[model samples]
Target: MVFNRPKKRAIVESGDGGLGLGIATFIANGEDLGPIIRHSFESGKPEALMQNLRSIVKKKEVEIEELCRLHYEDFIFAVDELCGVLVDAR
Candidate 1:
């Protein structure tokens, strides 16, 4: 049997390694996130939209190792919960 190379799962699995601006730029310029942000702004939820955007990039002085090891599904849940906090803050 032949072995295969490791797939580049980190980007797809970790919000593009958290340097997700390229993903954001692509989405903003392409068909996904950019459109969502546009719609959120048009819907008079600009503050909420900005809050969600901030939630995506929010960093702490110290990141918990548990968070650092989270898989994609878990990470999404964590971020969604975080967005909830930011939305509530508004």
Candidate 2:
């Protein structure tokens, strides 16, 4: 008998306040967060990057709060719902 393991989802966290909030908001919106974050890190000026991140976080504050406060299962469900919206919109 073979047992299948669950695939691990990548959790992106910058550990800084604004950047982390921005990343979480992007994930909740079903937008890809990797490239922008990568560019920020490579820019060698995290403070400037964080200023931009804060703007994003402010723009999506409500969604960010809702997503952040969810339990793990609820969070997964919420993300799935957002993804469904993306699929339907395309």
Candidate 3:
């Protein structure tokens, strides 16, 4: 019998008043998730990339005009999504 251990999840800090919150504050208010999004795209599977970007687009619930007005603030995220999806292809 083969026993496979579950993979460990990444540690994500979260808090409203602690250092976690402070970091979140900067990232959230900074209006930029570019670097991380790029990293995510470069690291993840391809299918995952597309799904992620599409999901982000859907979740934002904004029209193309609004997206453009926002200057594609979430574009990197979409790229990340695409990367993931492509990388995972067999």
Give the whole-model CA lDDT for all candidates, comma-separated.
0.53, 0.67, 0.52
Candidate 3 off by > 4 Å: 1-30, 62-90
Q: Write the per-residue lDDT of candidate 1 for residues 1-70, one digit (tens) a residue.
A: 9998643332222232232343344433443565555655576666665664575455331345446665
Clashes in model 1: which pairs? 27-34, 28-34
Give the per-residue Cα lDDT of candidate 1 at 5: 60
Q: TM-score for every candidate vs. truth?
A: 0.32, 0.31, 0.27
Candidate 2 lDDT over residue span 28-84, tens digit each: 557786766676778665676668667666877976677777666887899999999
Q: Which ten residues in a row have the lowest lDDT in candidate 2?
A: 16-25
Q: Would you give me the overall lDDT of model 1?
A: 0.53
What ranges in model 2 sit over 4 Å off?
A: 1-29, 62-90
lDDT tens digits, residue span 1-90, model 3: 999865443324433212222233334355355544554456554454345456556655666667687867588789988999999994
Q: What are the runs in model 1 whose C-alpha is more than 4 Å off?
A: 1-31, 59-90
Clashing pairs in model 2, backbone N/Cα/C closer than 3 A: none
Q: What's the C-alpha lDDT at position 79 in model 3?
A: 90
Against the true structure, whose lDDT is highest? 2
